[model samples]
Target chain A: MESPVDIQDLEIRLLLETMLHRYGYDFRNYTHASLKRRLLQCLAVCNITHISEAIPKIIHDRAFLDQLIYAMSVTVTECFRDPPFYRLLRERVIPLLATYPFINIWHAGCATGEEVYSMAILLQEEGLYNRVRIFATDINGKSLHQAKEGIYTIQNMEEYAQNYQESGGKASLPNYYHSKYDLARMHSSLKENIIFAAHNLATDNVFSETHLVMCRNVLIYFDQTLKNRALRLFDESLVHGGFLCLGTKESLSFSEISDRFTPVSQDLRIFQKKRGIR
Target chain B: MKSPHQRRAIVIGCSAGGLQALRTLLPELPPTYPLPILVVQHIPANSTGLHTTLLNHFCQLPILEANDKDPIRPGWVHFAPAGYHLLVEPNETIALSIDPKVNHSRPSIDLLFESAADVYQKGLIGVLLTGASQDGAQGLLKILHRGGITLVQDPKTAEAPLMPRFAIAIGAATKTLSLKEIGHTLKQLGADTRE
Candidate 1:
């Protein structure tokens, strides 16, 4: 007789496979503990316990899967999560990026677009806004819509202000947003250079040549094989000697392509692809 | 159920200043090392190649970036690629998770350590090396709580002291040594494979 644990494992695998075939968002490769947690959460909300009990309802119910995606995709991002990294970018990256006639910046997994606006504001301060084309992408359509709206709760502005100041703001942080009804609508000009769209790093191929790719706090959810695939795409997408900025907790040390890149600020998790050497 | 001999596996985590540190540390492991070496080096989604190429040059053992569902094997170095947290199952299978970033890192040392503690218990050996952040401290503590052995690079000699210092401050480390000492200790421990 098969043990209960074995049965549960099989059921979970089946549930994941069904989700993949029906929804096309693959969770098969995600770590088991996290996936199990999310699945349990989904079951609780739906008022069920077993995978078999939840499977039929999820397969027939589009709303149920959307809810699950929302649960799975809830990333904790606040404005300027690591302020010093941005500060270093303003000081180090901008000077070199400025030399280019026109520049393309790719913000991968740009959830809700706070970082995109942050980058835009920085570029504007450096007089590089007009010549820069920013591509901001996320897998969530809802987040993309919110990013395009360019509006945020004023409650968030306080933290944003602190982050902006720490990231070496040349002017008042409030200058970039119009405040009304405790909501801050960012300056319309910041969106002019940015193209926000849905792009899944898990499955999407490279879309454009980029001079700088800022993919922060996104890769930690991926398995190693997926990470390698994504890195290869990023490598192909970047122009020779392009800049790649990762989150402070992240590094390029174990990557297969570490030799192709050189650390700009190893402490800040900033790297520049080797020029003329690759 | 304490076995007659320790059923050992190696877990390593690195971040800021890690590439140079890894370049130094990974090269020191011989290909014939009998135990599996698992690593979590925080990186973006686009950098797994660095792990593979570096280990290929230095280690005689086969080195490969990990894949979801890959089984853990001795004499191989497996790295958590970019975005995922790599965990060890009770059966010693590699499980990948997209859990929200713990300790603000996806390839977080905490995730690896905590999971290994649950799965390998006293059989696990956790190593915290050069990094700029405090991600590994709590995880290493979990490992120690589960009776696993833990090691940290001596902060003074670490490329970045924040991570090692945090581990030491929390009293999670069993030994704090320089990279040279760490390499030598791993060689000895890894040589004692049961299978």
Candidate 2:
């Protein structure tokens, strides 16, 4: 007899397939344990026990699936997560990038736009803001909306402030946001060169060519195969010698395309696409 | 399937202000402790270097950010690279899986603890330390259910207390100690000494 755990695993696989086929959102390649936890959470929230029961409900209810997507999507992010990584960019990468007349920077999986703002601030400090266009994308609509609004809970400001200072901010962190009631609304000027949109790394194709791509803390949720696929997309999208920065735990070391990109800062998980990798 | 007394490995989960806590805890452990120590610290995917550098500075034990399919070994501290869940196989080897994020984290404490519980069962000791979220509670419970020792940091002494508090409230922890005491206690428990 198959164990209940095995049965549930199979059911989850079926549900993922059904969801992919029906809604066109591809979660087919996410890590299994995380996917299972997400599905279980969705089932619990929907007040159902079995995938059989939840699948039907989710199939007919677009809103329900949207909730499920939000639950499943990896959205946790902060401004200048690795301060030194940003510091490195400012100290090393930006000067070279400044030589270009126009720069297109992509912030993949830009949850709530904190990193986008951080990047915008960095660009502004480097005098590259006017020459740059940043495309910030995430699959979560709610987070995307929040990103567009440029607001955050006041509770987060202290940490963001610390991060900003560590990231070598040229100005006071508080200077970027205005306090109203209990929330801190970020300055509108930071969004001047930014465009926020909903784009799925799993299902969406490349939208633009760029000088740099920051997809930090986002790829670790994907299985190795999906990671390769995403990296391939990034590889194709980046211009020659364009930079790709990932979370510290993430690396391009094992990818099939590892040779196509050379390490900019191996410890910081920063890479630069080779000049002639077609 | 061995009894708790016969267990051979320890897994720890921590997050949110964990760097300083880990610096305090891990450095006290001797270089030659007897069992392997695996850790899951909730951090951004691109930030493994910070943990790697910090641990290297404090612990005499060899510490490396885990890679996919890396084998678990004694005398080393393996941290789940940011953005990936680290799991232990039944054979005591390490595996990386890229599922969705759990408990709002990728390198989730719960994911590591639960998988360790499955693989090591009574032979595991699970530790929950300072963190902001409730990620490790369910996994610690699984460890307890499987007859593993579950240690939680005393909330009052933790940098971030929500995680330890949650584990205590849920009855997931076998013991709760101050960070300093936990470090000494872990030393006695045999961390990464056996070559």
Docking level of model 1: incorrect
- Report the lDDT tens digits of candidate 1 across residue range A86-184: 888999999999999999999988888888899999999999999999999988777778889988999998877888888889998889999999899
Top-scoring candidate (DockQ): 2
Q: Which lDDT value does model 1 have at A220?
A: 52
In model 1, what is the error at residue A192, expressed in angstroms? 1.4
Q: How accurate is candidate 1 locally (lDDT)?
A: 0.80
Question: What's the TM-score of each model vs. the native?
Answer: 0.64, 0.76
Give lDDT for model 2: 0.83
Could you tell me the TM-score of candidate 1?
Answer: 0.64
lDDT of each: 0.80, 0.83
Docking class of 2: incorrect
lDDT of 2 by residue, B1-195 (tens): 333246578898889888888888888878777778899988886563677886797788888888654568876899888767887755566666555587889877888998788667677888899999999999999999977888899999998999999999989988999878887877766632232
Structural RMSD, model 2: 5.9
Calculate each model's fnat, 2 decimals: 0.12, 0.00
* Local error of candidate 1 at residue B58 (angstroms): 30
